[model samples]
Target: MSVGDDIPDFPATGVETIAAAARWAGEHFATVPAVVDGDLRWTFREYIDRAESIAAGLVAIGVQNGDRVGIWAPNSADFAATVLGIQLAGAALVPLNTRFTVTETGDICARASVRAVFTVDGFLGRPYADEFAAHRQERPEILADGASIITFDGTGEDSIELLIARGTDEHRREVDARVASLRPEDTGIVLFTSGTTGRPKGIRLGHGQLLRAYWQWGGILGLEASDRVLLSNPFFHAFGLLVGLLAALVRGTTVYPLAVFNSADALRIIEAERITFYPAPPTVFQTMLQDPALESTDTSSLRIAVTGATSIPPSLIRAMHDVLGIERVFSPYGLTEATGVATLTRFGDSVETIAQTAGRPVPGVEVVILRPDESQADAGEIGEICVRGYNTLVSYLDDDTPLTDERGWMHTGDLGTFDEAGNLRVTGRLKDMFIVGGFNVYPAEVEAVLSSQPGVSAVAVVGIPDERLGEVGAAFIIPKTGASVDEAELVASAGERLANYKRPRRYFFVDAFPVNASGKVLKHELVASVTAAPAAG
Candidate 1:
């Protein structure tokens, strides 16, 4: 909970946020290595200059401030610059995960009113240019079934290569002028989240919210002129877009984006670049720690290794510190609405607590625990974590309605308990709850228990609609590396510890869980795939 000062004012706009950082870096650390996009490299000044070009290009394309520009691409310098460029043009960027199927991307694109799409011709050693174009060409219901398509390189059915190529250097300058007129409260992003409402809701964040989060921790995150921040996650995520990209400017830090994450290579880059700051997700940490190269590399330069996006296992936190030699493993709890970080744990807290708790609210942020009746809950009691803060988003896109109830509090669906020390510990998602034989069972509880199993690497608990119990608990498990477990034995052990009703009725072991760019388990995707499996496949 250690913090330095009051939350500062959000730099009126997102472009201003990055521009400020570029100005600082240009003066103080011009020679320092910044971005590492595949093999392409840049200094802090060079990175900002590239963004200026893209900003101008976006403006020439008829994009206006608050206009949505959807992007579907991997983690690369182009993707990073486009985020800043879109902001610079006074436009909001809607970043879509490249990992999603065409159907998923198509649905999101349609909802956001995306005027233009930016995507790679192909990636991950797979040809997907056609998939990107199918959103405009085919019926979504029919396209959900895998359809082979071609690239939009003027073929018009497959990709946006033409659209991007069409922008000239002159266009780039015009776009920059357009970007210069943006307002702080304008929609900066339309982040899609899979909520229980059946479809993903566009979680909107304005320029003010985006800039405020970066400024709140600018000085604290050591975003000083000479520092280098490592960004390895996909650009589609707020974690990657704002914290790693936009935060670079306001906080005065240079960025080094890893297009692909290889733990061995990550160690090499840390040593080679002498990177001082990094914000990694749980999956990224898991990958690096498992690599044997960590033992041989001198990764002592990194000042902090922040982890978030999902609940990090305690073992992962300990391994990052005791094994991988990371200086700190802090977890900050936030959603798309909060502009990224709303709660943060200090760097040196014990792993057990750091891994389990989401820590205290950031300065000037107020968090409340609400009962079912909407009254505030006492400390140590389980309740919804409601937040009210300056960093909070203005509203959802196309809808200016308030997210709070009649009482004026954002009812974050996350369930948590505040300890006597006033730290927030997120337990589970409320929409994921199910009534098993008249008893309510939360998937996180069962998943945590199963994750502790010797042969289990990861597990996801879900409730399948059933005729008898109304809903039945199901689990998809990933066995530990080079290990195996019997489904019957695993189910029996779980049944022994819990009331009979809460025990999982079926178990299926899979090689991996399907996740989005943010490392969040796509529960709906898992449930859909599992539900379609005939008797657990």
Candidate 2:
């Protein structure tokens, strides 16, 4: 059935609050498993019950309505519970990336005016609490006056265990009143963008926008109770928090979150839990496929695979089906501003179609390709992709950057085109496109061509300054294990596959590319690495 005809019926869910959604999910799917972290498992009822306790605890500690509360930890059961607790306490959630440093976290926390932060003492051998305190001391304004820091894992009285112990019947009653008082239009979350490019921007989004958007996602994806999802995406990002975790609440899917992605451990969980659905960046799948344990592990239980965060390679889609045993693979595209989903490939789309395009706009979102003059571009014409919908964020917190023009159309700053079927083909970022001798060179196009090469595992193309041409493409190649490529031959292949101006002038053979917390390639860092080297004529 076409997406237009098969939309699933969802609950009226009038409140639009995360707390309300959790209550609905718990009432309906109470006995079903909601989350499984390590050996700990929580039914939907248990999950909501814990969230209520946390909410009461937060309220007892003075977290008021609309106050910003930051959660700084990796993906875990605690992370999931705190997200609901913050909202249930009538505060806006601010999820800090686990990969962020003390200074970066402080910058965002200050900008968001976070009054309280829930974090860990350390994770993966780094002391976050100590580092954050030191940074806050240095920049006294980094935290709001009298802000409280609560640790998720510690022996101190301020730990999560002690806080929950402090929750009384009176506090719980206050929590109930707080949740009831929240309006659909209330600010629900403030997610800061990854600061790979510059200082991160805090995106303020309303509960209504987030809940409505994820409902569409759950409907379009055909998610249902009993579908076990392995979420490798970090909960800090919208993809993980909104789509991965919150979507589960909407659909009642059992979610297993990996704190940090480990291919071998992921394989073990897939085998042990009989995981049916998994979604992550293409690199995560690549790493899993390359792992030696995958040959011996049982992954046939996987039914659906969702990928995005970078361009999808046609070959990888084939591998996901043939090599990884996934039945249906989907590629979706969106940014933080759009509430994490705008376009999604249909369930039964042809592999080639899914590989070639990012898919049609999800219901409610209107996508248009417009030229620089704001004129609509014809089909298959390369232009900036714009979106308008209820999913578009309200605004960037603390920055005057306009999110939309008068007509509510958000210029995505991404260059793309629509096929005859209205599927989106994102070519590259407008800021990332460079001019080579008068010709426009899109790095994504060049990278796409090179990615099909036999020995290449992953590739990133960045435009570097040239003495002759204004800018030229530099290719960074991470070759497949036990495989080798001749640079001249690879360059010759690129020459045949692309136009002269789009071809790379230099190739850097590397083990890996520098990526942000979200697994997006840091092109600026690649450019810096290329510029530090001698010019390749």
Candidate 3:
């Protein structure tokens, strides 16, 4: 039997576009609490209305169909509202990571040619709006001509309040017209990759692709109106925006947006709000389990837990069930190009399966293991994971490069194998990339930055095992001949150029690298050297 062939029936099957999904949610789940952020609360009816107003606001600000709009704020009700609003206004949503430096954010804005960006001030002691303004002033060509930044809490002309106030009856009509004209094939989102190929590529996903994949994902998780979900993941990621938010929206699940994750606070909210659905990385659960408040916190409300990592200890899964009282736990696999999800473990899966594998492919999606020569791998043979289905991305923005082959399979660059029962065990990655605290880091991207540093002749980065974080980048640097390199200066330079997560945790000054016959640096040897030498750095 084909994968995705046995998908169960789900609600809102006729909702094609995100605009229609919002309207459907309002009509069916009206009066149901949709979102809760601090003191702000809104029912589905009110939430949809507010989103429509934002749509009108965007139209009033000269946004047109197919235009790209950006949101550079933490997880909040306004961020969620703007997401649906952009879709309603017939614009593609480009979510910016809050942890990104000004240069990184500016590059995305320039690449996407975003017309306007919605942001907030005073998040994590950083003035996001002011920093973007400085970036624009320093590098005027880094953003599209006339691109504007609108802050959520400001009262200036560029404030979101004024933008919303500009919405009139005329703009509302335009927004409605745009919504009615939307098609499933139209682009709904443009999510950038983690620079796996040295430069981040914008992934274009269609309305139908997101709705189909995530609707099924939510259905598989048994999401419903009674479930209150705590969204701790940042909205900039695919898992947070599409899997956590969009899936919960369609299922009538009440969402609680947590901008930052604190173990004590998470436990407090879970108990107070009776949050039933919680999804996070393995590190989060580990941290919560270690928190002293765990003993006093009432966590019986947690029913479902979802997580994924390179390596998940089976003991952790048992602890989550035995300690936290979570009834269902799922481990899934996916990437940005695959619409955020391709497979998921079922409800009754064993603890070992949930921990050791990423489960089988989702309904309507096909996953296969391919050998180096593009042949199908045996059930137990590890090879590149390929995906083909409606969930595949429409294209990469501004690049004519074809991601899918003639057979319509997109190579995932992840090494994995399928069990006889269709369970997929992710073995390793074909690309020189690693996940640091659930965020992907590409060595080439890090090397690109380190190579530009003044005293660095060559640099190679590799993922080293970290107890707290799954993995972290370790940089091996070769200084220019007769030039002294200061580790402190390099650290400061990297801190300025890269996000905190992407920065190397350890720096090793090396004269030469272990190379192969073709002069390729052996990254595995570098990783092995760290294991052999305790204080190599």
Candidate 4:
């Protein structure tokens, strides 16, 4: 099927949704706690006020509609307020991943033509202002008024609190007053694509796209007021930013946010906050569930858990429910392009379905599976996934090339098939599928087999370039329960399901994989890790 073959009229309600949440909170329990940080709580009313003041800060600094501002901080209440302030001020937002090095962060800022950057002096441990000063010095254009350093905890320059404190009540009113002028079609933010293989492109998103995805996913997943959502994931990415923060706002609920991910701290907060909901990258949840305090932590209060970022193992989904005592763990499949939720396994699906399938498409969106032969896959046949809808991103930022091309469909470079029940099971990135001596080897398929075996808790399969075979497979395993797992036993497990040519010639049983904040194992890092071994040479 071609890209342009989309059905029209997928209605979406976006921009005004936030106003509804604000009005609801303002009228009902305005003084009730809405955001809980480290010993800090902000009531719904207070949150609105803080957001207003921050917007005033932006306005005073000359930010306006269409202006791009960089939010370079960890997950914090200030980070939430800063984003809201950007929204209220009618400015486009660019959230800088806090894990990015000074050089990497500077490159994105320069590329995006970022106007202002709001960051902390030191967070968790890293000193921001000093490192950024050097990085910015290398490429000096993106700085805002020496680029206006607005710190969260007074560690960098003037505290984010002070930026608000200096603004008058009238200034704050002006900020909120400007919110009335925004539209659903206006570019809310340029969500950058993760640069795993190429330069990161900004995924252009409008108000309608984000809001519709939130409500649509919220309906399927059920986000409610009584649910105390614990958000420890980074707020810079869409998973943490929109799905975690914005979703909570739309649902009119309490969100306990953390500046950085600390497993111990998150568990402590979950217990103390009586957190009822959590949506994190699978890797984060898996590691958190493995914590020694898992049994003792009052996680019994947790009702629903949502996992995303990368494809989560079915084993992980089932383990969380049975072992951690969570009622359900939903897997929402999406990218920044779809806002966040495109297809998801909703509540009440069998544990097998919840773990194996990515679930059906959201009501308005259309998905098609087309093979290289230009034909549709009858259920159970794998093909490239193409999607089109109102919530879909229009194009890559700064470049008008429609992300989906003339055909109206964005080709997701993933291989998967639909079941009789219509649940989509993603196999692996199409590009990652390697050919070893004419034998096709899907890394994810091998990884699944490896991780399912006894004593193997985590597995990542990668292709290593070889002279004669063209490319060969490699497997990295993280042993179960912190035990010392043997390499021979693991290799033999794979040899059962996989052909001799498809099996890995080399293996790595490590303490952990080099993962990003979102929990994706940097497969490229695995390449480096494997090649560095003395045996490989």
All candidates' TM-scores?
0.83, 0.96, 0.82, 0.91
Q: Candidate 4 at residue 163, lDDT?
A: 69
Please identify which of the two predictions, 2 or 4, would achieve the higher TM-score against the true structure.
2
| Alpha-carbon runs more than 4 Å astray in model 4 | 1-25, 144-146, 155-157, 309-313, 466-468, 499-501, 515-519, 528-534
Q: Candidate 1 residues 1-537, lDDT tens each?
A: 375444455534344433333444454556665576557887756766666666555555566666677777777776776666666666677888777787778777677777667776778865556566555566544322232222322346433333455568787666545545556666777777644445667877776666667777664454566777788866787777777777776655667777677777778888998887778777677667667787788777876777763355677777777766767667788777766667877655678668777788877678888989888899988788898887664577788887766656778888878888777888678887888878888776677666656667678888888888899888998886677888877777787777788788878888888765446677878778866874764
Off by over 4 Å in 2: 398-402, 535-537
lDDT of 3: 0.86
- Pairs with steric clashes in candidate 3: 4-363, 4-364
Model 3 stretches with alpha carbons more than 4 Å out: 1-10, 432-537
Query: Which one is best on TM-score?
Result: 2
- Candidate lDDT scores, in order, read 0.69, 0.85, 0.86, 0.74
> Total clashes, candidate 4?
6
Give the Å error, residue 439, model 3: 29
Expressed as tens digits, the lDDT of each residue in 1-537 for candidate 2 is 355325754675365777788888888999999999988999999988988888888888888888999988888888898899999999999998878778778878888899889998989999888888888889989888878788988889769988898889999998888888888778899887776667777888888888888877877777779789998898888888987998898889999989888998899999999998898888889889889999999999998887874466788899999988998888888888878778989888888778878898887788899999999999989999899988775788856576998888998889999999888988999989999999998887888788878878888888899889999888999998888977887798888999999999889999988988656789898899867765632
Candidate 4 TM-score, true structure as reference: 0.91
Clashing pairs in 2: none
What lDDT would candidate 4 get against the real structure? Answer: 0.74
Our model 1 lands, by Cα RMSD against the true structure, at: 5.1
- lDDT minimum window of 10 residues, candidate 2: 1-10
Order of all candidates by lDDT, from best down to worst?
A: 3, 2, 4, 1
How far off is residue 155 in model 4, in Å?
7.0
